[model samples]
Target: MNRRYVVHVDIDAFFASVEVLLDPSLKGKPVIVGGLPHERGVASTCSYEARKYGVRSGMPLRKCFQLCPRGTFVRGNYRVYEAFSEKFFRVLHSYTPDVEEASLDEAYLDLTRCRPLYPSFTAAARDMKCRVEKEMGITVSVGAAPNKIMAKLATRMAKPAGFFEVPAGGEENFLRGLDISDLPGIGPKAQVVLRMLNVQRIGDLWGLPRPTLRSLFGMGGEEIYLQSRGIDARPIVTRSKPKSVSRETTFLQDLWDERLLLAHLAYLCDRLTLALREDHLYAHVIEVKARYSDFRTEIKRRLVVMPLQEMGKIYKIAEELFRELFASSRLALRLVGVKAAELVKSRPLALFEPYSERQERLGQALDRVRGKYGFGSILTVRERMLDSVYDFEPRRGFILKTASLTK
Candidate 1:
């Protein structure tokens, strides 16, 4: 059997790096993205300089501010970062067709088949890394190993524009002495148990049999057993189509106003439909969720005869679902959400008069505009009310999250 060669590539501080590219003056400074320090939101990303001060992504904006008072906080433009992500993926595709995108800033590439095209895996990985930086103006850290687990671990070892490799026979040596947390799925709770078991490092677990580990951790035990031995049989493949897509948010306060809730629902539906069209799929089922101020949750779902792709059609069904949930309860609402499910790749074409061709054309045009300008570029009148309620960016729309800040 041919030994598998997997390489993991990750952009260093993706959001902060993109911000520096946008404003060269911000380079070398501690730049934080998400919202301003005084704002009530989590830090999306921060530069290494900010990291040194203990400012990390997902940390509260207030805490981040306390850590790096000199840092520049930005209400980041995701549309801009998304644009760069396209270029980043394009670079990977040029190297190999077998690529798995883990996120906007990270991917795994299978280079075993492409070995004949270059002198070695290392050379191809180097060329791919250089091309990504050259095309996107951002540095990426990479790691290569005989399998995916070791490759991911190696990449963790190589950060902020660095590369490391674990040769075919060296996986065991590479994983030795690493912290137990370095292993995937090892959490604080698991650490307590592992510590009691006297397995402090990856190498320490080498003594335990697979059956023993399985009994200790259930179904995931096999994964832990194999990963600790530097073996990961997972293949690098393109992502499968999602079973469903959803977008929702918790209100800043319990809302009793139906108009305000519907307005926010329209915004969420727009975002959800944008995602549906991006994947070239349509939903046969539409679902809406509402969480009342009393913490009771209600949901309503409808299956349409004709699957939906256009925002107008999807929003229509979603509106009905929301109304159903709203009318069923008299309590104030704390959260609202929309979900699209039972997806199919082929969007149903509107061939009859009831579904006008003009409406189809208009939906296409609107999607094109949003694709180029961003989701916030075109908002319904109802969605416009969100402009005054939340911090609005012309093309990026409102920053939706669990907590909201009064505009």
Candidate 2:
């Protein structure tokens, strides 16, 4: 039988490194990507030079500025980042079919079946990492071990352009002396609790009874207990579609006007369906959210018998939900939102299906135009009211953050 081997690859400071690669002038400088320091947003990633000033991903740009005032800040271009991610994944897929995309910058590969072709697991991982760096002009850290947990941790151990491998029987030795804080699931709170218990190292956690660990961390404790001993049975999950996609915005002022609210709903639904169709996914569950002026929030959701990808169908259902929710109390709203969930791939059409073929074609047409001209180039007559509300820019869409997790 072949031995199990999982290789984890992580791009080092992916966004920051890409910025440096795009413009060599950024090299050796403290680069922070995500937003300008004067802007209202968080840092997506930063160069190691920025890290010296305590900068980090998800830290507010204002606070990041306070830490590294001289840092070069960039309002990152996600489309470029995504293009690089596509090339990065292609390199991983060249190695094995079983590649799990952990995020845009990281992936896990099951290379056990292909072991016979390589001199050693480490050699195969190193070659793959080197190819990514050479092709993408980005540094990558790699890890190889018998299980997923150890493999990922090994990558963290060998970060900033390095490689580490744990042979089949060496998981315990590889994990033993690592700091508890270095473990993925052990957050700051866990570290405090563990420090109080004198469990400062991965090896220290291994000696504690499983039940004690379980009592400390609840259901996740079992995972922590197993991970401490370099045991992880989680399979490589490679699903590219997310479980849900949503778009929402808070009004600058409370709104009692129903027509304007519907306009907002239509806009949000349009954005949501565009994301769904891009991924070749459909959703059977539709949800609508509304927050009244007094801080009361409400939502209405339904599960359909059949799934759909067309925006009109989704908006019709969403409109129904919003009307019902709005009529329930007829109060002014501070925010409105829409969500599509229970995602699945679109099924092949059967002969003379009962679905709306025209709506489907319309959505396809809209998607094609949006692909070239931009999403806001054309909007439904209903949603056009937004032009009067905000400083509308068809190509760039206004300054509203839809809280859109497009992926």
Candidate 3:
């Protein structure tokens, strides 16, 4: 049988690394990108230097500052990150067209066909890292294995800036001594659950019967079993669409006013609708989530007869759901989220009805104006009201201009 090989590549401390690229002096110094000490946000990413002080991504910004007072903090620049990501992918495409982008900083490439192009898999992996670092001024680590799960695990073993290849038929040996969390899809919550059952290592996961594992993890257990033994049947999908699109906010202060909550929902719906139009997709299901002051959460959803593309229509449905399921008065809400699921490519022909055509024209016009001038050059009344809630940085213009051209 022809063995499949997967290569996982992840950029090192992506946002923090970009800061270092702009200022070489910050290379060895601890760097963090996220909110300020007084801000109600979390760290997006932190340098390894900062990690030494126990600073890590997703940790609250206030906590990070307490941990590493001397660390430099910079607000994240998504546009700059996106620009760098394009150049990064261009280099990867040179090696293989079969690439699956796991996120902004990580991807899995299928290089089985190009194995003979280089002297060895390790050499090809090294060359890939070198090309990215030399061309983009960014460092990446690579992990190679016979399948995606193993490749992902291999990358964990080869952290910071390194590369490693798991030998074919050595998947079991490669996973034997690793913690359960070393396997992909095993998150902190899953690890805690597994530990409760006295399963601490990847090897221990294999000792449990498949049926029992399934009972423990539901559908996810079968995936864990296959992955623990290095048996990933999932192919590298190049063009898989997003399962859902969502917009959410963590309130700086918990809110109770119905008018304020509605205003925020309007803003989120507009943002979500704009995203759907940009992706040329539409959603048939809308979901709303509310997290109370005590962190108690409730979700409400409704399915539409037809996929929707208009912001007004989506917002109306979301507003109705909010009113029906949530206490409208005197309820402290810590978070609000809007999600659109059951996506499909928006069909132009199907959108020829009068209402749909008008929405399509409006969206196209707005996009054209934004493309020519800029994103903030055009905005709805509701968006302007909520703009102050979002983080603002003046340097964002430079980053946006640079990324738009490259993308």
- Model 2, span 89-167: residue lDDT tens: 9989998887888789999999887866877777788899889999999899999998777888889889789999998
| Model 3: lDDT of residue 91 | 89
Identify the runs in model 2 with alpha carbons over 4 angstroms from their true place.
240-407
Error of 3 at 370 (Å): 40
Residue-wise lDDT of candidate 3 within 126-219, one digit each (tens)? 8888999899887888899987778877888889888988989998998888999776546455689999989998999888887897687653
TM-score of each candidate?
0.62, 0.60, 0.62
Report the Cα lDDT for residue 12, model 3.
92
Clash-forming residue pairs, model 3: none
lDDT of each: 0.81, 0.82, 0.77
Go through the candidates in order and give the clash count of each: 0, 0, 0
Q: What TM-score does candidate 2 get on C-alpha atoms?
A: 0.60
Ranking by lDDT: 2, 1, 3
**Clashing pairs in model 2?**
none
